[model samples]
Target chain A: MNKMQQRLLHPSKATRQDRFGKTISLICIGFIMILTVSIIGFIAIHGLATFFENHVSVMQFIFSSNWNPGQLGKNGQPQVGAFAMIVASFAVTLLAAILATPFAIAVALYMTELAPKRGAKMLQPVIELLVGIPSVVYGFIGLVVIVPAIRSVFGGTGFGILAGSIVLFVMILPTITSLTIDSLQQVPDHYRKASLALGATKWQTIYKVILRAALPGILTAIVFGMARAFGEALAVQMVIGNAALTPTSLTSPTATLTSQLTSQMGDTIMGTLPNNALWSLALVLLIMSVIFNLLIKVVGKRGEMKK
Target chain B: MTTNETVITTKDVRLYYGEHEALHGINLDFQKSQITALIGPSGCGKSTYLRCLNRMNDLIHDVTITGSFKIDGHDIYRPQQDVVSLRKKVGMVFQQPNPFPFSVYDNVAYGLRVQGIKDKKIISQKVEESLKQAAVWDEVKDDLTKNALSFSGGQQQRICIARLLAVKPDVILLDEPTSALDPISSAKIEEMLLQIKDQYTIIIVTHSMQQASRISDKTAFMLNGDLVEYGDTKKIFLNPEQEATSDYLNGKFG
Candidate 1:
């Protein structure tokens, strides 16, 4: 009777606990929303301020390659076109994605599908170790080793789009590979069995069935890799020569939006037109990454739908 | 049923997953153009036996199988045997309806394409014929472009059969093909199997005793990694020579 009577007292306690849980979760979600909204809102306002303060046309900023920020006597008229930076950023990111995707897929398939249990266990930690190594270390390696190798091979200053692409490729390899492994591992074993039962070879089963089934996940991985490549500043800036010009060849030096903003942020005075332009660049970078993130969601959601 | 020719014969077959032996010296034979239903309790090696027909069990790690599995006098388990070609002769359908997440046409065309049959007309004709043979052609012919996964469970299972049939395998192994389906779908599959048994050797692993009695010409009862009984389905169901087989059929104990 005592235990039963005590059980009667549990409803209110459970309700209170439920309320607390709900409140905490709501607060956490609200906090994230507020932070993201404030950050994007601030960037948008400052980015548009460049056009508002200096009579700089948005079209010119996006299209014109000339980017000489005027000082004294030129007043607010700053040559702030970032078209070259946009092209360079895209070229570097695309090149990195192209370089990393096939290797990532191959490594992922070998690790998750083909490797023995013990070998895979040993290799997994090594791959994760690669991921844990700071991006700056990769940058250092690129500047020291990759740049020189490029110079010896391709015969150029070597601190160019290709160097940046290689460094970004190495930096994003672990990210893409791990994500691909995760996606490949998620496919049910039944898919492989079905394909193999149809007399398809193991490799055929992997590429035709397993890879097709895991496509959306792999796409999400590549998008994440590309986003990282696009948003990367420190590593790419260090290896790239940071010349504010469009790259005509792989060996030609070019500056990405990230590189330009990172380089000029400290040089510009507070509330100056150049400072607003930098903010505008930051906004562009943010927009690019957010678009990729959205693409990830779209791809993941489609995968879930298929499942 | 026809000429008493053994399409599949296994001699002193033993399968081990690492240290544990799952099949203990299994010796079984199946006839050409007949249905052989494998009946057993769970984990009794019936599914494992079915998989051994196409060497599907080879996909698992730490599986050490010492056995001579021969199909039509060709040693299937021999190292020299090409698994791809062997599987082309022995297709398999899993317990669940595992249609690839493509259109119905593409799902049926998968095996042919894997064999490098690239002519669009050949693929289209084979896909249509296989779908018709699987008895789902009328329902899906209007929507060959529709996603295979969008079909009902039973229809998806039939599509998988069509996929296997597209390659024209000599033997089709079905592992509990109708277990996940409704009774009507199960009946449809049973009827379809009965019709197709004239052309292809059928090996099915089933949990249902009634299904075994209804569809199979020969039934093999496996009990704890051993072949407890293997005989004509009627005799095995009604007057089994083994006590364990009768006990299981009588629902006394598994």
Candidate 2:
């Protein structure tokens, strides 16, 4: 082969650089994957230890509200049932998502359709700022304002699922609104034009056409918000009044899985049943988040199929 | 042709997009139940003039329009004029086939539903009639529940036309509707337009001179936002009055 052909076939400096860049990115991705797998694996091993090694019944761990993991019950089983915390977590997450969805959709519509200029210049930054605010600040606000407000109005202790839901509603509102804005913006400009050219009123166009087309995207946004609400720890921990008891009313004291994990993780000894029980709670949270992610993917896929 | 009752009349219609003037004093009238073609080079404001007829330009920002646009002897630009009802009276089919990402049945019934017609029997009847009129009912009749976006481009365009026809508009403005389609699909659209021209006043913007000569009864040649020549399609295609029009037809310059 000629020297020119040899040089062309061999790796040049640019080709070498490209290989190096690819290797670097591959290494970074490998590191992230390893970290994610190890963390999940570690949590799963410890989480399962509570049931397998400690001889706790899986049914009792899930359905029983008796959560004294350090002690044994009359049945000689570890009292580590987490049914109350599970219920509390789902209740707060669902209520917060329901409360925030309408408000988020409304704000998103105003930003994208009604007053786009003012919405972009004035409201977008504000919503982004809300997102950037630390979760601790939200918790602090809830502890002082919402808890006291609920106390006066509803006439109870005010630190309960209701308080957590209200705080979560505020925290997830910006997330849902910003994501909803993105989905609404993803709707093609031609759709709006088509509806208007049909002689439909502005309200009808937005309501019937735009919203229906963006339905899957909007549902995905709400699921994302729900995921954030489900996994949030500190803000919900502060206001949920961590009692480890099954809540009978919105105003009664309750504890979520995350709150219990945060409050008790430090106190339990490593390798003990108490600590392993906390791991089980963590496992539940991890699984729920994975489900949320899967939900987003399914919704996104359905939206694409419609196109 | 001149004695026929006019469905749409525009006098001295000038449009500005921000600081840029797009349409300069366009004076034209479309005859009732006749096909009038607007032929021009790219960006000569044919689509802009078409949009003005239905007040579709109001959706754009920083657009200033002056002069009069009257449809069926009613001033459409009047402040108290209901733009929605005006648009209902004059429907539009766009350059791109834009059916809502919905079932065929829903897409065709959208206009009637918007008009607050709730009777299922009437909506189904209108949907079928319009789809047949647009010459696509035979292809899509069994699959009305299927998504409209799943169809081929030609079929989608026909469905869009069907969607427009369901409203029973008096005037139909087509803005280069066939410019994006294949020759076969374009032929189908031309045939469909000829079939429906007797019932609706049809104004079309076309880049294809052959299409203009083939389907249009009257053709208006526009150059740089000015109406250069307006006459019978046969006369315009056979013997032109203006040098620019002759040059454009003879492929001298766009």
Candidate 3:
């Protein structure tokens, strides 16, 4: 056969629709890559400008606690260190993780392993509705119910770090639980049967076999939930009192980087040191989110390697 | 012909899934301390019957069983018979190797620990003994800390068998234990079964007729939940009284 004949014979192998579909998908992927790179580049450049152009020392910015964007520091420099806000962000997110993990795991286990199929199917959508609630709605609840309750019980000033952490805890609970259930469900049935057939009870099979297999996925869920809690601003801000000072106790008011940015960004003029410092805060948050997400991929790879 | 002791006895066994009946009136006696191979085509209820022996079918929902199943004259279908203790006496291995996501030592030790054995030294000894009996101790002795899944497919399957052996059950039911393995691995398993048949009553559900002839002392042929023939391995393969059994062995059709 001639080359032309051979080529004509296999037209359906890579048809016009196939090529078109491939081209369109490649273009979509390229668009997303370009968007991500440009946005990250913009944040990096604008965020670093606060330190480079305004003559703020990197070490001073990292270690110093003062964050008064309106006031000048010693030698007539704008006070731009965000040490207190960073600590508050981490502390509140850690507290939320500690509060949410046990409940999420319990719910996930009940849904995936213990509950009847009909019950699990019914409970899944209802529990997932918690994630659909708006952050503003959660903020309102924290403002109206949780903050006051904390004040009455713990003798606090009502608006405090504890309030913020509690609100974040509620916000991340559904995210972790739903993802954990999915991960647990991904474990093959044969492992459970193998354990059970060996005379191990159902609870034993869950902890020793099913849970061990689903651990990487559970860790990924937690990392994603923690990232969401760390990035949450609106709800945490409403209950965290928006204070800029360092918190001495759980009852003491505090400020996160997001809360500070939201409060000061509207009034601060562009190209000023205050606006630049706000950009720096966004930069830090962006980096942390990316790192947390990357950690999931690393964990998945290690899990596969072990297997 | 019936001089050997019976380890498992089932009469008028009927299994149902919700409303549909899958197995209908299976009656047979499995021989004690010997390999009994149940051979037939797919969807023939061989595996379902195997699972029924140890109540593994209870894991599925809406499964109702009515029959008299007994091991050493103890009625297994009775409500008072605890499923956990029943399973302890009759262990099982699956078609696929399903070791827990733990080290090799832990996989072998899982059964004893389930029985609440707390002594680490005793667990270590039994783990070694079970691995040796399964003929995998030499290959894994230096690497007991390695994950069981990190081993080859055949090694993983042997480890699963070793896990079952560690429990020291009176009976072991295998659901096509070598179907997922290569030819060499399948032969290894067949040879291992030959060596261990004197101590454990093993009931295996197999698709390959040759494997049944190679390892089993007694053969039970099933066709869509009906036992067509049950006799010595040599008699069933060479002079089956039923036409369907001979047809299946000759490969006329599954």
Candidate 4:
């Protein structure tokens, strides 16, 4: 009788255990959100303070083609202009994304649609391995292999904007292609069937139905790949032929924001104008990354709504 | 639209999916401008035979077919035959409502666009005519640009039928087109089928005895992948000759 009464009072131990399980899940989610908020808050506070404290005009900071913030007026104070770095950085990233996107899409299509199943299974792992390699190694290879080859072809020293773009392109190809394949594969088979059933040829079905249906996903993949390429510093610095000015042509040396930071950070005084400029550039890069990430998220959300 | 006009004839048709036989040497004739119903339980191969009409099974892996099937005197399975052209002549509606993820108007115009008909006027006219024929024009006329996925299940099924009708195919295949709809929707589809039969030779696969008896002029009953009995719909339902057919229709056994 005593044991029966104890069982009734305890009921099941599972009730408390389930509550504990749910609590753990909430805690994990809260930790991630807190971490993201802390990082964003830190960047905004520190980065925004530098821009406001300098008393420099935002228009000159953005539109000026030269960044020489160290040499001052008749007083000989430091003056720096950041326009060259911003323009060169965007040019390099856009060129690389444009060069790589088509090849990535083609490779993804071949892997998912054209290759036999057995061959595809064998190749997928090897292609995915490209994403795991360190960026520094790719930089070294770009310095040795890609730079000299371009110099020979262009008939000059090849460490320039074109060389840097080529290296970034090669680095981002695998990311775009793999994501593209995933999106293409996610398109419903019914769309393909309906297209074919309407007397459209195989190529027609892919072009008209399958690709169109997955267009948002493909666009998101390209945006993510471009974001990765844009942020790549080590590889671009190794081959960009940093000349501290905006590039005039593919053969001319140029310095992106990352190269500028790498060049001026440790060698210069900690609180100098160049150092402050590096922080500003970092903030700009952060803003670009957030914007692109938001685009990817919105596109993904749209894909879900369609499904 | 003569009653004696024949649109498709299958002679000793046999179909296999990999190592398993799904249809075993079934002979049947589908009349032009009339509705023919193929009724059977699940796995009886009625759907498989419907797919055979347009060579849809060719899309599947490890599917083998051995038979003589003709649509307007053209052997569909012959090496020289083009499956695309054959399919254009014989449109199909699936068991599930599968309107393309497009605008309601675009769903009806998909067939014409694929056939390279670019005149907007012709497309709009045909879209309206097809939707009216499917009895969905009144519901969707105000929202032609809205996505087809926004429609109700019954509306989507009707939109699919409208899609099939826009191609002006000589024959249309329905694989339980209304099975996914509610009772009211199913009745609407049945009424539409009766109206469209005069212009298109229609072959329907159904499990409902009442639907078969109500709309079909000729009925074929299949069991265990074999055609057990086929005759006038009235005879098949009221006076089936084969014991298996009688037992199946009487609900004695599947």
Best by DockQ: 2
Pairs with steric clashes in candidate 3: none
Error of 1 at A144 (Å): 2.0
Cα lDDT, model 4, residue A162? 91
What is the CAPRI rating of model 3's predicted complex? medium
- Distance from true position, residue A125, model 4, in Å? 2.9
Arranged by TM-score with the best first, the candidates are 2, 3, 1, 4
Error of 1 at B38 (Å): 1.7
Model 3 lDDT at residue B252:
90
Q: What TM-score does each of the candidates earn?
A: 0.94, 0.98, 0.95, 0.94
Q: What clash count does candidate 3 reach?
A: 0
A1-307, model 3: which lDDT tens digit per residue? Answer: 6888988887675697899999999999999999999999998988888889987787767777888877897768788778888889998889999899999999889888888476588877877788889999999999999989989988867887899989999999999998989889888888889888999999999888888888898888888889998899899889998888788888788888888878778988888888888999999999999999899899878767654
Tell me candidate 4's TM-score on chain B.
Answer: 0.98
List, residue by residue over A1-307, the lDDT tens digit for candidate 2: 6999999889999999999999999999999999999999999999999989998888998899999998888988779999999999999999999999999999999999999999888988889898999999999999999999999999889999999999999999998998899989999999898888899999999999999999999999999999999999999999999999999999998999999999998999999999999999999999999999999999999999997
> What's the ranking of the predictions by DockQ, best on top?
2, 1, 3, 4
Each model's backbone clash number: 0, 0, 0, 14
Reference-based TM-score, model 3: 0.95
Docking class of 1: high
How do the residues A42-91 of candidate 4 rate in per-residue lDDT, one tens digit apiece? 76765554467765566766776556766564445334556778888888
What pairs collide in candidate 1? Answer: none
DockQ measured for candidate 3: 0.75
**Interface RMSD after interface superposition, model 4:** 1.1
Give the C-alpha miss distance for residue B250 in model 1, angstroms: 1.7
**The best candidate in terms of TM-score:** 2
Cα-lDDT of candidate 2: 0.94
